[model samples]
Target: MDVIYANSELICSTNASINKCSRYKGQKTLKKEVTVHKWIKVSLIVLSVCLVFAFGGVCTLAILLSHATPLAFFNSDFSVPVSDQDQNATDYKAQFDALRHQHEETLRKLNRLNYSTGCALCAVHWIHSGGKCYYFSKFKMNWTQSRDHCVCLGGHLVIINSKAEQDFVNSNVKVTHWIGLNDLETEGHWVWVNKQPVNDSVEFWIKRENGIREPDNWTKGHPDGEDCAGLGHPGGETDFWSDAFCSLEKRFVCEAPAAV
Candidate 1:
């Protein structure tokens, strides 16, 4: 009878061990799959950007055609939201990356704003100041998604080039918002969405309390450190630019040339 009891206990322990091993293997497989998926997305972003320079902005996104049937099934509705599709949607990703790369090249060569064409009226839900039209979105999105959304809406993220512009944007700020500034290409070298490097002469960063520094790389919020910029709310020394995680979802400000 004692031998029988010992044999039963051994069988139970073996089954438990098998279950644990199976679960561990399953978790590892899931993690591996997620890593591969992330790499694929990153590859797509690079491919889209390179394709823009190669094709000179003439070619359209190929993935858009893949969902032709589904796209055509729904009628266009512009009022719902600026970014109705998922952030991974290729239409805006392709356009945004292509537009960004093109702007980077053109802004460097021409040293000009590509979309700031003529003096124009601000559209509904947008503010007019300094001869530029700025839009404050109610929805929130990550830095990359917000950047792409601005391009989708015929503009880019707000580029506060001067104190006047900064003050104007600051006064109207209802909450923290994403700006066009980022150090994605190179750490510590901040640049605007227009590809213009930050002019060190002017400064408006979050107040240095206790001398901690504004961009203290808080939390490694971004994969390459705190690579994105966020505009703080209206407060003494608080209404300024601060580095934020690129993955953090925040409201964004969009800037464009006034329509004639």
Candidate 2:
């Protein structure tokens, strides 16, 4: 009986040991599975965040590209709507055209008035469209010097505001008379005595080959670096102008005008 009991006790102990080992192994396996699941979840979360950021970046880039316009003329490859720029250019051109037309009408009215009502012994030899009369000086003058003379005479050097005025000046002056147009105030932006912009289309007559260096426009020789302008006869002939010195004596034109 005692031996049987010992055998029984030993078998029971062995069974208990096996069950504990199995339970421990089961717990360890569950723990490993949980760790693996946690790692997988963390990896998925990280990847999702990266993907969202990448997609957002792509969307932003696409949006920017859609708005950009190609500017090939200026060597800018990007494309963007140039509607505003075009509108601005159009507005400027319209303003310039209107100003030119107004100048023309003003001169026509002056011519009609002059024909009806003549002047004194010193008849109006020249008529500026923008309300002025010009009497070419019998002497020559440099640009600055001539301008000063005009100011003293209570006016400015004659500014050819239109083709008609230019033609008129060309007809009256036998020699080039110092006029008010010059790039002296701002180089490359030629302005008349009245500070009006010289139209690029109306080519001012220059001395033969005088504008060789700057082939874009007409420029008479003689008063180099003096910022002077002169008038010429109708046949593209330049007759008068002076350098920077106002002291030099030359023929001058006086101006007066009928009311517009």
| Top TM-score model | 1
Candidate 2 residues 180-202, lDDT tens each? 66666665676766777767676
Superposition error at 31 for model 1 (Å): 72
Candidate 1: list runs displaced more than 4 Å: 1-119, 220-223, 233-238
Models 1 onward score TM values of 0.53, 0.40
lDDT of 1 by residue, 1-260 (tens): 99999999999999999999999999999999999999999999999999878786444444554445545535554423335565448677798688878755643443234345443466588787876789998999999999999987778999988998988888877689999999889888889998998888766777665876666666643445788988973242337888878888988999976543
Give the distance in Å from residue 13's predicted Cα in candidate 1 to where it truly belongs: 97
* TM-score for candidate 1, residues paired by index: 0.53
**What TM-score would you give candidate 2 relative to the actual structure?**
0.40
115: Cα error in model 1, Å = 17
